[model samples]
Structures are given as C-alpha cells and as structure tokens.
Target: MSSYKKLIYFTLLLILLVYSVQILNIARFPSQIDIIKGDSRNLNIFFPFSLEIMEESSDIVKINSTNAERLSVGLKNSYNLESTNNGIAKLKLKFLGIFSIRDIQVNVVNQAYVIPGGETIGVKLNTKGVLVVATSEIQSIDGKIYNPARNAGIKVGDSITMINGIKIKDADHVIQLLNNIKNNKVKIEIERNNASFTTEVLPVKSKQDNSYRLGIWVRDKTAGIGTLTFYEPNTKKFGALGHAITDVDTGTLMKAENGEIMRAKVSSIEQGKKGSPGELRGMFFETDDVLGKIENNTTFGIYGTIYDENKLFKQKQLLPVGFQSEVKLGKAYILANIEGDKVTEYEVEILKLEKQNVPQSKSMVIKITDERLKEKTGGIVQGMSGSPIIQNGKIVGAVTHVFVNDPTKGYGIYIEWMLKEAGIYVNNNSEFAEGK
Candidate 1:
C-alpha cells in the first residue's frame, strides 16, 4: 500500500479505539442511584454520546425531555432527573445508538433527622481480651533467653482471648494462668485481622521472677476524651470521635467488647502549634451520669445507643443532616466544648470540598476563623475530633484531623458517612438524582 493510504488507515484505527473507550466509560456507571423525595440531580455522561431513557419502573421519577407518547433524549450528553414521589424506579439507559443497554436503579427516600453533638465526653473501651502490644525475650530457668510469644506466632495487634479453653481477662489474669500451667503447652485462641485461630504455646519459667512467662505485653482497657458528633432521637443512637479509636502503642483499630460514654471535665488545654498537635486534658466525672454504651469502634467513629436521653445536650430542635453533594465551600461553624462542659459554636471557613462517591473521613478542608476559638485552643486540637460542623443550618460534617504543618486548618468528615456508620440511614436516593 502507498504511504498516504497507510497513514489514513492508522488514523481510522485510532478513532475506533477512542470510540471504544467512550462506550466502556458509559457502561461503567453505577447501576443504582438514590435521592430524597422532591430533590433533583444532574447526571452527566463524560464522553460525546447520545442517551435515551427507554423505560422507568414507576411514575415517581421523571427524566428530562421525557413524555408519555415517547421517551427521547437529545444529544446533550447530560440530563436532569427529578423525584416526585417516594418509590423505586428502574431506568433503562440506551447508549451509543442502542449499542449497549444499562439498567439504573433509582430510589427515593426520606430525609434524616439527628441531634448535633458538641459535648466533651469520656470514652472507656475494654477489648474482648488482652491485646498483644509487643513481644520480648524472657530469661528462662536455664539462664537462656526464650521468646515464647514469637515462637508461637503471636504478633503485635493480636488479641489473645482464650488459653486452654478458658477466657483470658486482664494482664494479671494471664500471668496467673501461665503460672498455674507451668511448662505445659496450652491452646491459645487469638483473633488477628478479624480471623480466629488457635495455636499451642509453651510457657517459659522465668529465672528473674520465678514465675511462668509468655514473653508478651498485653493491654485490656483504654480511656480518653472526645467530642460527640450527633445523636438520633428516633433510634437513640449516637456517633462520636469522627475517627477510629486505635491502640496508641500498636496503632490498630481497638476491638471493643464493651465501652462507656461519660461526662468529662476539662482540666487544662495545651495549645496546638506547628508540627505538634495539642490536646484537652480532661478528667472523667465519677458520677452516675453515664450517657451511653459504645457498641462499635469503626473507621468512621464510635457508635452506640444512649441510656439516659436527659444527659445529652438539650437542643430545642434537631438539625437536618446534609449529604456530601450538598456541602458547599463557604462559611460554617463547628460546635465544640473547649471549656468546662459548656458547648460553644465557633466560626470556620470551608476551604475545599471534595466530591466523594464513597465513604471517607476527610471530605472537606476547614480552617478556624473564630477569634475566641483561636485564642482558646490555637485551632483544632486533639479533643476536637468529633465536633459537629454546621453549614446553612444543617449538620454537614465533623472535625477529624488537624493539619500537622498548620494547626489552624484541619480535615472534616461528611456527616452523612458518620450517620451511616452509626446505623442511621439517610436519604439513599440522592446518589443519582440530578437537579436542574
């Protein structure tokens, strides 16, 4: 073939490859989208292609430029969808001249209600058993060092729940069990990475202490203070600590068999500075003011149900939860308790908003703008992790982490995700709904 003819053939092949990519991109959209009733959303198709909504499951949803006689979409490549009622609708999308058909599930749901939390509370967590924090060498009776835990495949972050079919309690309890067993091999039941297994471990007689040793260090409980994010009145569920409570030594998510939320008194404040994060030094009030029980410690936060509703902050009205899509880059406020038991609202500016389709902790970047807060805590401090952020009279998110280099700026988690982690369902149908 001639050189000119060969170049023309190559050009055609490249065009075909581009079109193929567009086709795949259009087909890869999520099959299901959710929206709240009376809300609209914009659905955009990135590539240059035509789309048509062939059928809808119910009359609760309406697509742009759609009529009863025929459903046709123009070559705009983007369309608006509105939910008129609360129901499920199945939309058939015909892409690229009917070359591919994709089904999109549209669900309309009700709006959510939750009480915004800003009180400083104490958190006490007890693991199912003792967590192995480290392994060490034990001097045995024969004047030799033996690492029984390492030899038995027990590593850091593993929870030793049972030994010889008996439940292990605290560190001292494990010591007593080992002393009683002496040098005999015992079955050690452990949980690692959410999986359970058993291994036979032999205890070494320590020459220094004249007792049996496992050559491991374990912890059974952890306590700290954090701000509350919200409380659902309908379910009596509450979420706090916008981030997970991980083990300080091992830096792993702590598995809580049981925990408590109690009132806290701020003793002192260590102001935050560049390259260092400050903290609120507080003491748990030793009273019968237990507010709730922590049942879950998740990546998003800690979730539980309140026992005494009267113990929580008395808000005249509950705040409407805001979805991530509705979060805007502008002025906002964070409710936090920096001083003794008094929750105060501080002004903050939402610097950046991230468009996230999945659940994530840091959804927005916020800066402390309130003069009083800056003077008090020097920006976002350690105990302000779960401070509720309000935007446009709606609870939008919570404070998660502070910027290491700039204490004045920090990351905020979308409140919708925290609510979901707390087992409170929000408007699920807003994911695919497009507004005009």
Candidate 2:
C-alpha cells in the first residue's frame, strides 16, 4: 500500500469516532421537570431541569433511591429539595429522576372550621333570640279543645309570646323547656302580625320516641329567602338570602375580592333523583354585577341586597314571608335571567321539602324539566347561586351547587332560611297574606 492509501483509512476511522460521540450525547440528556414530590418523607423539590444538547461525551447520571445519591459522571442540571413535613423523604433530580416518601407527620389531619353543623348535637345559634318565621300562622300546641293554637286556627305565621306562662326566648331555650316540661296542660301566648292571643294545650306523646312532644317545630336559626328576614316593615327595608355563601369543597366563604356574580343564562335544567339531584347551567359574563349586596353569609346562602323593584316575577306575584309554610313539594318554577335584560321563567319540581330539623341547606330537592333551560346550562352551574326558587307561585329556595360528574343534579337553599337570617319575618311570622 502507498502512503496516500494509509492516510485515507485513518481519516475514515476518525469520522466514525465522531459519529459515535454524537449518538452518545443524545442519549445522556434529561427531560425538563418543574416539580416533584421526593421519596424522602419530609422533602419536596422543584426542578428546572431541561435537556440542553446531546453529544457523545455529554453527561452520565443515575438516581439511586437506596443510597439517596445522584450518581453523576458528567450530567449537568441544578436541583434543590425541601421538606414540608417530618419523616417524609423527597429526591429531586436535575439529570436523574425524582422520588417521594411520606412520614407519620405527613398524614396528620387538618382541623378546619365547617359551617353550622358539628358533632356536638343541638341546634346552632345564628342571631341572639331572634327567630325569623317562615309561616304566617302561629305554631300551635294541641290542647284538644277549640284552642287558638290548633293547627288550622294557629295560622302559619304566628309568633309565640310565652310558653307555659314563661316568656319564650330563643328556639333553643324553647326546646330545652319543651323537653323537660312535665305539665300536661300549659299556657301559650302568641302574636300575629300585631295582635296577641293566649291559649292552653295538653302535650301529647311523640309517636317516634314516646316522649312528650310539641306538635310544632320551632327554629332558633334559619337560612332561607323571604320578603324580609328583618323588616323595618316600617322602614320598608328588607333582607334576603340567609346562609353564608361558601365554596363547596373548600368550605371557605369565597372572598368577595376574588369572586364576582355575573348574569348567567340557563342553558338547561334536569330533575333531581332520590340521592342524585340536578342543577341549572348558564353562560356567564364577567361584566354582570350581582343583583344584591352581600350582607350576611352562612352555610345556607349569601344574604345580600336586592335591587329589583318590579317585585312580582313574570308569572307569579310576590308572596310575603308568612306564606312559605304551605309551600309543598310539587310543581314549581324559578326566576332566572336566561335572556338579555329580561328575567325569564323556568319550570322545576320540589321533590322533597326538608323540615327545619334537617340540614337542607340544599333545601327543596328539585329538577329542571324545561327543554330551553336544559340546552343553556347543561344543568346547574356557577353564577346562578342566588336565583330565587319558586314553588306553588311562592318563593321557596335558591340554586347552590352542581354535581361535578352529573350536570343534571344540583343543590338548593331554602328561601325561608335566607329571609330568616335577614330579620324580615320576625319570630313566628311564617304566613304570607296575599295582599299587603
């Protein structure tokens, strides 16, 4: 062989070596990862790792969990690990991989405050001694005589002035005395609108527990909608929306600063089932401000200011606070702004009317059946929270939540509860007179 031939062979060998180096570099690059929970029970790491270039002699790195070491021969990337809990290990990697671990401390349960209901067992207080009434007829005890406190005679919107000659305080105190009452005959005094009356009644044994029981349910706290939870009926001032508005899963009142109520157009509505319910869905724009001002909030609904002066809905006249008790579970309707600059009407059904004793913050389980409503909202969605629930031509509740997976099912709040919180219907005024 000549010298020229030898030179050509050496050059070919050099080219092959370069090609192999390029292939190696490509294989060594790591993928970019922003964050990872590490294997260490107490550690977490945020990685800004990314693959820069692939070269034959790039970097060689491997993540080892057992040794807790990032064996790096030449790999390049930065990583820092931190721990938010004890006994938890986290392995953060730049060129390697990440691992996460949990310690006992990581499993600690967080104690957060929930609305109204707790295990303590008893009615919770909203306002001091103030019992906003939902029914106009007074809750009467059965004296078995032609007593004014009789179910029909008592009237739905009547308020008790005293029980057994003792001035009634709050519903809780009434409950305590009623439970301990050993007297068969007791005197009851009540007020209706402004008139006052007195009666006597003999207690009867409750069928469920065989304990002496009052025939009526007296509520200390209420969360529902009514003409006025409190009326300066003199000031003509009214309050509506009883319970506090809160985020479903977070159980935290949505910060007014971070949230807004927009006008939503209901696209659809679905009926509720025994356990599964339905909701209203609509298109919402940020420009729409809420119809009222946020006043008081609880688990029930957000009480706020109302600006609508027309008062009567498109189809139904406004029923006063006292009339709510007669609201049965049946055909109903809702007042929603499903249109532009107009509040359209939609049909719903009250499948169940929960009594005051039960937690029906999502009151009056209902289902939307209108075709036009169904197409708009897909069922109940956000921004329709305060929409007034109307049943039997009366306001009963409002929409609260939509079932995540089930667009048709949603929760509702009782209108009575909202009104009660506002102090509109003072103690025992559950009945609503058709006119003034």
Candidate 3:
C-alpha cells in the first residue's frame, strides 16, 4: 500500500477510537454522587484514562492522593475520595491526568442514623374528604328515581370537599349537611383528578328512612396492618408500609388529612402459595389508641410525626442509612414480627439491583433465605411490607412487594426514597445517586 493509503487508514482508526471513548464516557463516570461524611468512597475509572481529581472545596471533600495507585499496565483505574464535612463540593475530572473531561458535583452529607422499626403497627387513615366510590339511583319519597351525583358529572374517584360551602369532614358530615339543606338542589364542591370544581347535586328524601340521600357511596376512612420501616428521632418522623394505602372500593390513593398508628400484635399467618398471596393477621393492642398522627399518604408510603414517642416503641435499635450505590447484591437481614409481638431477625439475599436515578419503589429484588422466616410466614406476607432490611450495619431498604408466584421472593425500595418521602432527608445531597 502507498503512504497516502496508510495515512488515510490511520486517520479513520483514530476517529473511531475517539468516538468509542465518548460513548464509554457515559458509562464510566457519574454526573453526581452523595458521599457520607468521614467515609471514603472509590470512584470507578476504566483503563487507558487516568482522572486527576481536584476538589473545588478542600474543606468539604478531599481526594485521597495516597490511595491512588498505578496499575500493572501503568494506567489509573480508580480514585478514593473522603468526605470531610457536610457541604457541596465540586470535583474537576481529567482524562489521562491532563485533559479536562467533566466536572462532578459532590454532596457531602452527614451520616444519618435512625431507629429501624420492625414492630407490627395498625394503621387507620382518614381521607382528606369524602371519596365517592359508587353511584346509584336514589328512591325518592314521591316514587321518583334521582341520581344526583352521577347526573352532576361527578366521577367514582372524585372527592367531595364541601357541601353548600361547609367543609366536609367525613362521610357522616356530608350526610348531616345534605339532610339540613333546605334547598332542593345543593351545591357540592368536588375534587377530581387534582382539580376542584363546584357542581349542583339534587338532594332527594329517601322513601324508606325519610333521610336525605345523594345516590352515591362515599368513604372517608381506611384501616389496615403494616410493619414499621423507620423512625428518625431527630425529626420525630416515621415512615411505614413502603407503599400507598388505596381505597378498596374506588382503588384510589387515600389522600390523608388525619390518621393514626397503633400498637399491633400478629395473631395468625396464612401461608403463601403460587399465584396466591398470603397475609399476616394482626389487631391493635389497644382500641382507639393513637401512636402517631398520619399527615400524608403517598405512593412511597405513609409518613407522619410521632408525638407520643414513649408509647410507640421501646428504645429501638438505631442504624445508619445506606444509599442506593452503597447497597450491594448479597446477604442481608430483615426485622419482622411474625409471632405475637416478638420481632425476629431473618436472613435474606439481594438478587438484583437496578441503576435508579429517580425515586422508585422497585429498586432491588430480594428473597427470603432464612428457613425460620419461610416456614413461619411462607416468605414475605402482606403485612411485612415495611420490614427494614439491614445490611453491613446499615438500613439499606424496606420490603415493598412480594412476588405472587414466588412467595419466597419480593422487591425492596431503597431507604433513600423513603427518607425523602418521610421528610427526614430534606435539603441534603445524600439522596442523590446518579446512573452508572
């Protein structure tokens, strides 16, 4: 081949090599990371490229130059970073120890520790207002059929906020307001799909009971049993269930304005089978007892502030939070109360993990490895949702779901998302974990 042909082939090879590195850039480096204070973390860097870490704020985070070592092939593969303080630090990454590649924003947050909860707790949640579950025709006193809510364009999942400008407290409150309405057509304030509007619903006197009826079934409260995930003493806040509490009738997320948690003891357990999910039967230790006030009901879980801390739990076991990146696929233990009020530790294994940049429920796949737990509850039962998963002396996540076909297996949500939902991780860089 001629010199010109050889030069052309080399130029093409160089272009392809550069393009490959640019594509690998997306996989090799993180855009941002959360470093725990006083702990060192290693950053992954591939061969053929050495990153020179320069901390913008040396006081917040310092790159450990001592831990940097040259590979057998004379390439830098990783860098160790120590978070010294609770603040944001900028890191200037370089390629081959010379060329600037990109800048990484580091959030050095204090290592947060909280009490890991395992005791079964009874939950009673009241919706913000009356949630319409169904609509039916009402039998009027004059033998007339009237569907007031349906005809007024109210939906099944709609929540009635007020009746004739009076704030609706519950289903019973709406009934009292409807019966006292002197006008035939009553003004109803409805909240549908996050937007609120007023619609006129005709009130009809029932033929049998002589009571005013709206021809709609509205529910204002729900109750169930779940395991507690965590309680942060610093914030006096607690999170539980690892999932939302939805209305059984309308299948809508119960928007909670007020609710309570109570001490509960597991009574019985139904063994799970393939395609058939089992449940843990529990009852409140004390009737009408309020352990805490439920403030918010969300997809993540139910969050609330526990004012009666002394009545809640016996001095609980505290553990640090393990971020998403810190959670590895290995053996872990979970705290679950299977018999009466006794909480026991069971072994579990993390099968898989997802690179989640955003908050999600299914962050890791977990399976029950302890025979004691499996024989007792047939793996993860219904009420075991918020059982705290502990690994490496940290609270890594909470049990969120169980596989219907494989009862021994289930999914867990990282504690990072739960912390944010519980308002304990507010304004901290500790929750941010970028994609690989």
Query: Against the unseen true structure, what C-alpha lDDT does each candidate score?
Result: 0.84, 0.42, 0.83
Instruction: Write the number of the candidate with greater lDDT, choosing between 1 and 2.
Output: 1
Better of 1 and 3 by TM-score: 1
Error of 3 at 277 (Å): 1.2
Worst 10 residues of 2 by lDDT: 113-122
Each prediction's RMSD over C-alphas, in Å, is 4.7, 26.9, 6.1
Tens digits of per-residue lDDT for model 1, 1-436: 9999999999988877866766666656656666678888777653344445545544777777422223333223456778887767777666444555676777766777788889899999888889999999999989999999999999999999998999987888899999899999989999999999999999999999899989999999999999999998878999999999999999988888899999987889999999988999888954557899999999999999999787675644698878776789989999999888888999999999976655888899999999999998899999999999999999999999999889999999999788778867544434323321
Count of backbone collisions in candidate 3: 0
TM per candidate:
0.86, 0.36, 0.81
Instruction: List, residue by residue over 1-436, the lDDT tens digit for candidate 3.
Output: 9999999999988866865775466455666667777777776554445555453578777775532455433333566888877777777666555677677777777778888998899998888888999998888889988887789998899998888888889888887887888438888888887789999977888887998988889899889899999998877999999999988877798889799889888999998888977999998843566778889888889999987777756567678899987999999999999888888899999999987755789999999999998888789999999999999999999999999999999999999889989876654334432110
Off by over 4 Å in 2: 1-243, 247-250, 254-292, 306-317, 320-325, 358-360, 428-436
Best by lDDT: 1
Model 2 lDDT tens row, 1-436: 8999999998888766754563444344222111112221112222212222112212221222222344433233332222222221212223334322211111111111111100000011233222323322222233232222354344444556577777666676765666678546676776654467877765554445544544554443332222112222232333333345433332333322122222234454444334444433344444443333444545664444444422322232334331333557677776555333346567877676554422346655677776677677655544445556655544556666656666555566765555545544333321211012
What local lDDT score does residue 306 receive in model 3, on the 0 to 100 scale?
87
